[model samples]
Target: MARPLRFRRSPERWTASRVHDQLFTDLDDNLGATAVDPTFRPAGEWETRRFEMDNDDVALFIWDDDAAYWMGNTETPSALWRTDKYDWGEVPYQVARWAQRELLADLHEESPWLEPYPHVSWFFLPVFMSKDGRHTTREFFRDHAAGFPDAGRDEGLGFYEEFLSTGVLDEYRDEMSGKLGTSPQFDLVRMSSAMAEFTAAKLLTDAGYQVTPEIEVTTGHSLDFRAAKGNHQPLVEVTRPLPPTQRAADTAVAAVRETAETKTSGQLSEHGGGAVLFVDCSSFHDDQWRAVRGEQPEVRHRPAVVYRVRPNGHAEGYTKGAVPLDLDGAIEWV
Candidate 1:
């Protein structure tokens, strides 16, 4: 899988001739790239050139008297040394904005079908147009229906587009979106697990809590989320069970219990309590989910929510012990 775009620093000093021999030669031979105008004036001493290639590949080269940086989706030159990878927001403002605009234009141009969902396009730009994760990530929503066994591509995309448009998790975009991964090949189980976080995030916000993700604790581990409502804050750890057919568990009920038990015994146990567990059964189809929901079996953890959600905006579940957040509005108590 290809990595997200980051700056690669070159030790060798740049000359106009050197840019052609060392940089342009590699990209042109590899991707048939051409140096073109970026249209925007750079903010500093760096002279910038944008290279656009066939098959949706691009790389931006920026250099000044002291240093040269390469940021793009193509093969990096061997001469350039990789620098520390910063989050998308941590990159320089001008460079980040420039890369975003260029990549977004390519995204819309290539996948015109995604143009309607502006929020989804913009929010997932980092991953949707990432070097190699682009096709696999986009296909997860388009073909897999975002892990809904019974939902169509549109239903799944629209469901997530709505939640993302709320901008509740926008601040944590890098961490949250990267969870979907950038594998070159398609993977259903892995991609679905990533969407589970999105589902969990929606539940947290809809239940009226200001949510922060990847919360660090004294145990030297990070909890999935921290849900804050008024003065109350509850740590939340979310997990999703494999459908009965995919796992060793014989029944859907058993699948729920078995999967939940794994989380309860691991991180939650290590934290020594004070966190709520969320077991999401969104991957279950109607009949499979009905079995789990009917029984509402114990997940072996206190203050836990066992729920199944549909792409059509319906969610129902049962809770154990006393749940800290007010989830009554979003989750129909069963």
Candidate 2:
């Protein structure tokens, strides 16, 4: 793992000979990268060139004599001194748009399975091609079923594809996708934990409530989500219990209780109230969830929900206290 897909600005000013020297002499010889024409060029004053490697890695260089920018999924050229990285928003809007289009085309061509799920791919392209998170992130969906148990990659990808296709949470794409983490190592628990936010977002959106994530409260803490419809606005904090095998908790219910308790006692405790606690047991097996569902144990917070969701779009749960949101449509009350 390297780093997130971002603008690696060149320290030295661009010249045609240096650009050619780097691409042909260094990248071509060592990295096997060859210059290729991009499908759609950005309409701008800056000169742009595209390079691709045999392994399907693509890099784009947008430069004028004044400055140069490098972006892609490969090892950045060693000759070009890369300094500060730029998030998508930090660069010129046209450059970001052009890079996204060019890379997305190459992305779909290499992994056709993802083409049908444009929204999901487009939303996560930053991390999906990130230097550190790329392989592991793609593997999560392509191999690990995107964190679903007892399911294959297609089911998991399709489940998210449908939800993301609705565009309900598209406005939050940049920050939300970054939550998946662009660290250099594969940490399933950490990555899966980030996805719990998406699962919660789907739940809130499916329930017809507008969902906004990372709501900072007066307590100087940021809650997971805010669900609103009309004048009704409720803060939501989501927690996920590891499956029985993954945690030391003796049982699934205990796992749920313990995880939720950790959350409630931390930020929610400081916030003092009016938040809904959503206990996501999606990682639990069928048997594990059934046992937890049998007893809606207290999670040290009222107005809390204990729930599990399946890839087929079915969810069931029980509420501990008077939940502010009417979730009958989104969850099957047990």
Model 2 steric clash pairs = 1-132, 2-131, 2-132, 3-132
- Per-residue CA lDDT of model 1 for 113-202, tens digit only, reads 788888888888878878989899889877889899988988888888999999999898877888888889888888898899899999
Q: Candidate 1: where is the Cα deviation over 4 Å? A: 7-18, 29-32, 38-47, 53-56, 63-69
Give candidate 2 misplaced runs (Cα > 4 Å). Answer: 1-3, 8-15, 21-33, 44-46, 53-57, 64-68, 74-84
- lDDT (Cα) of model 1: 0.84
Residue pairs clashing in model 1 are none
Per-residue lDDT, model 2, residue 19, is: 79
TM-score on alpha carbons, each prediction: 0.90, 0.87
Deviation in angstroms for 207 in model 1? 1.3
| C-alpha lDDT score of every prediction, in listed order | 0.84, 0.83
Give candidate 2's TM-score: 0.87
Clash counts for all predictions: 0, 4
Tell me the deviation in Å of residue 171 in model 2: 2.2
Index of the highest-TM-score prediction: 1
